[model samples]
Target: MRSGKQADFAYQAVYRYMIDLINEVSPDVRVKLPSLRHLAERLNVSISTVQYAYSLLEKEGRVYSVAKSGYYALPVSAPASYCTDADLLERLYAGTRRPGMQVLSADEPAQLLSLDASLLQLERELLRRHPLQLQPYSQPCGIWELRTALAARYTQSATRCWQADDVYVGADLRGVLEILIEVLGLKGAAVLVESPCDWLILRLLRDAGVRVIESPCDESGKLDLMQLEHLLRTESVHLALFSSTASLPPQERPHAARLLEQQGCWLLENDIHGELVFDPSTHFLRDLVNPGRLLVFSTFEKFIGPEAPYGYLLSRHLSAPLQRQFLLRAFRLSPIRQRAIARLYQNGRLDQHLRALRTLLKEQAILMDGYLQRYLGARLSYSMPQAGATFWLCSTQTVDMRRVFEHLLARQVVIAPGELFSVSGLYPQHLRLSHVFNGNHSLDRVMEALAEALKYGRIG
Candidate 1:
C-alpha cells in the first residue's frame, strides 16, 4: 500500500515535469518525449507510471502518440477538430431531451462513415490522376497493382520480405479463412484460439471440423499465459489465431506479442484494426511477432465499409501448390476498385485519411469512456478498445444485459450484447457500445439509455 502511494506520487511528479517541459516549447517547435523505458530509468520511476502519465497527457491534448514510433509534442490547436468532453457530453445529453430516444445502437465499430460518397471521391481522384483502365476481368490473386501495393504496405514498417504474388486480394474474413483451411489442409488439425473470441472466427473453425481449443483469459483480460504456455508445450497445436489487439486490454499487448513470438506456434495475424489505432507508436503483434511463421490478412472493408469490400492475404511461405490453390479458390476484386485503391496507396491520400481516422478514433474513445464513467459508474466494467471505435464493456452477473438489450431494442437502438460475440454465449453481462456516429445519433444519448437500463432492472 505504501509503495502504491509512492508510485502515485511519482506519477504526479512525472506528469508535472512533462507539463513544464511541454510548456517551455514554442508552438512551431517539435519535440519527442523520451521512450517509456528511457523516461522510467531517467526519472527513477516504474515504466508503468511513466506510461500512465503519458496517457494522461495525451488525453489532455498536450502530447501526440504514434504507434510503433514515439510520443511527440502537439502544436497549439492540434486538437481543434476533436470534439471536447464537455461539447460531446452536451450533444449526447441534448439527444436525451427528446421523447423515446433510447433506441438500441448496434456497434459496427470498424466501419467507415459515408461509404458511397467516399468511394465516389476515390473514383474521382483516380480519374484525375490516372487514365481510366477498368478491366473487364481480373486474376484470382487479384489485380497486380493492388496486390503489389498491399505487398509494399507489409514491407513499410517491418521488413517482412513480401512480393506481389505473395498477396491474395479478395473475399471477406470468413472467405479468406476458408481458403486458408483448404490451402493449408487444416481440416482436423488442432488449432489454438483465445476464448471469448470474435464469434465469426470461433464458429468458422469449429464448424469446419477443426479441433479448436479455447485458451481462457485471466482477470486482466490477457491470455492466461500459463495455460497458453502449457498448451504450446503439451498440446499438438499447429497454429494460434490471435484475432486482434481489440480483444485484449491495450497495456497487456506487449506481453501477448512476446508470448506469440516465444511460444513457437505458427502465428495467424488478423490485422484488421491495425491501422485504426489511437497510439501512433502502437505496433500490432502481426508486425512485432516473428514473420517467418507469420500469415497476415485484413480487409479494406475494415477501413472503408462493405461498399467496396476489397481484402488481401499476405504470406512469404506461399508455396507453388498453395499459390495455385489460392488462384483457383480465391476470386479477384473488381478491377476499377483495385486500381482506385492502388492509386490511393501510391499517392498517400489514403494514408492521410487513415492517420486522421486514427486520431478521431482515439479522441472519441476517450470522450465516450468519460461518459461511461459518469453514467454507469462502477455498475459497468470495460476497457477502452485498443484499436477500434467501440468500448468492450462488462457488467455484474446480476445485471441482465439481455433485458437492457431488449429495452434498447424496443426503442430501435440495436446494441450488440456480449453473448453475440461468442459462440457459447459467454459475456452475458457484457455489451459493446460504439463511439462512431453516422449523424443519426450520438454517444451521449446512448449513455443516457444505458444508465436508464441499469436504473430499471426489469425493463425487459
Candidate 2:
C-alpha cells in the first residue's frame, strides 16, 4: 500500500486535474489545471505525481484508456444525451408526486391510500411464511407453483390448456411487450393495432420501432376485422395485437378472433381487464384460443390489487425450448414474490377478493350511470360495460376534456382522459371513470364531484 502522504498527494492532484478537464471539455465553460511538473518539483514530489494524475483520469472514465497507448479525452456524449426519451421517461418513473393541475393524468385507484392495509397485511403474512431474497433475481420461469395454479384455473378449455412453465413474470404489460418485440424481431415491422387501443401499448410499440396500422373499432368495441383483413392483404403485418373480450362484449370476441386468424397474422391478446369477474354462462374464450396463432398477456395488478408484483404471459405456438430459454435468461432470479402470489390464490383470497370487487364495481357502474343521466341531462353519453371496473363517458365538442379534468382535480376528483386510451390521439372527448372505490363514502364523493364537474364542463 502507498504511504498516507503519497495517497493524499495523489488524491489532491487527481481531483484538481479532473475538475479542470471537465470544465475545459464541457460546452458551458473552461477552467485551468495546475502545472503538473512544476507543482510536483516545487513540493519535492516525484515525476510519478503527474503520471498518477493522468492514470486516474482514465480510471474514472474521464478519459479513454488504451492498450499500448496513452489516455485520450472521452467523447463528450453521454448515453442519455444520445438515446430518445431516456431523460424524460426516467424522470417520469422517478417522480412520485401527483400532477398539480388535475387528478386525471394518472391511473391510480381512488381507495389505494386506505384499502392498502389489507394487501400489506397479506404481503406481510406471505413474507413471514416464505422469506424474500431481495438481491438475487427471481426464477426465470417465474414461481413454478404459481404458474401451475394459474394454468389450472384455465384448464376447462381442452384446446388451450397450459402448465406452470408457461407463465412469465414481468413488471407490467409494457415489460412483456418489450421482450416480445425484441424476441419476435418486430423492429421496423408493420403491426396491426386497434385505433382506440390502450395508449400505453401503442406508444411503447411505436417507440420500439414497430410500425402501427390503426383499424377502427366497431360499435361492439371489437376490431373492425374487415379493415384488418384488407390491411393484411395489402401490406405486410408482423403482428396483430388487441385487448380481449373483457373490454368488448363477449358475443363479439370469437367472431373477431376468427376474422383475425384468416389474415395469417400472429395474434397478441392483452387481457389485463379480464380479472374483473366473468359470467359463468359466457364462453368468451371458447373458440378464441389458437396457440399456433395467439399470444396472451394478463396482469394480476388490476384484479389482485394495483401493487401486485407479477404479470403473466402466455403463447400458444411458441416452442418449449425457446420459452425455457427466454425464462432462464430473462428471470434467473428468485421466485419468492411469484410464490407469494400463488399462495394467495391457494388460500382462495384472490377469488374472494375478486368477487367482492366485481360486486362493488357493478354497483358503482349503475350509480355512475344514474348520476350522469339525472344530473348532466343529455350533455354526456356513456357506454356502460356489462362487466369491468370502469366505464367511459363521451362529451360534446363544446366541452374541453382537459379543462374539465382541471376543474375536477381542483375539487379533489380524479379521472382518466379519453386520450389516455386512444391509439392515435383521436380522443372521442371522453373520460374513463373507475368504480374501484373500496368504500361507499369515496364512491359517493366521486359521483358527486363528477356530476358537478360536468355541469361546468360544457363551458369550462
lDDT tens readout by residue for model 1, 36-136: 78987888875645665665565334675544578777343222223233232222222232244442332344443424355657666655565435433
- lDDT per residue for candidate 2 within 1-460, as digits (tens), equals 1243233234355557554665455442222334545645554544334444543443233443222333334223222122123222221211212222122233322233222345556556655665543223445556567778888876666777776666665644444666777778788998877656665577667767788887766444555545666887788887777665544456656666676566677878776666654452445443474567777787666566533524567754554643655553453322434555776778887777767766666676677677667766576666666556566667653566665665675665556667656556566477676655444245456656766666677653
Off by over 4 Å in 2: 1-138, 218-225, 246-254, 278-280, 319-334, 438-460
TM-score for each predicted model, relative to the true structure: 0.69, 0.67
- Please report the TM-score between candidate 2 and the true structure: 0.67
Instruction: Give the Cα error of residue 364 in candidate 1, in Å.
Output: 1.6
Clashing pairs in 2: 137-333, 137-334, 138-333, 138-334, 139-333, 139-334, 147-164, 148-164, 291-316
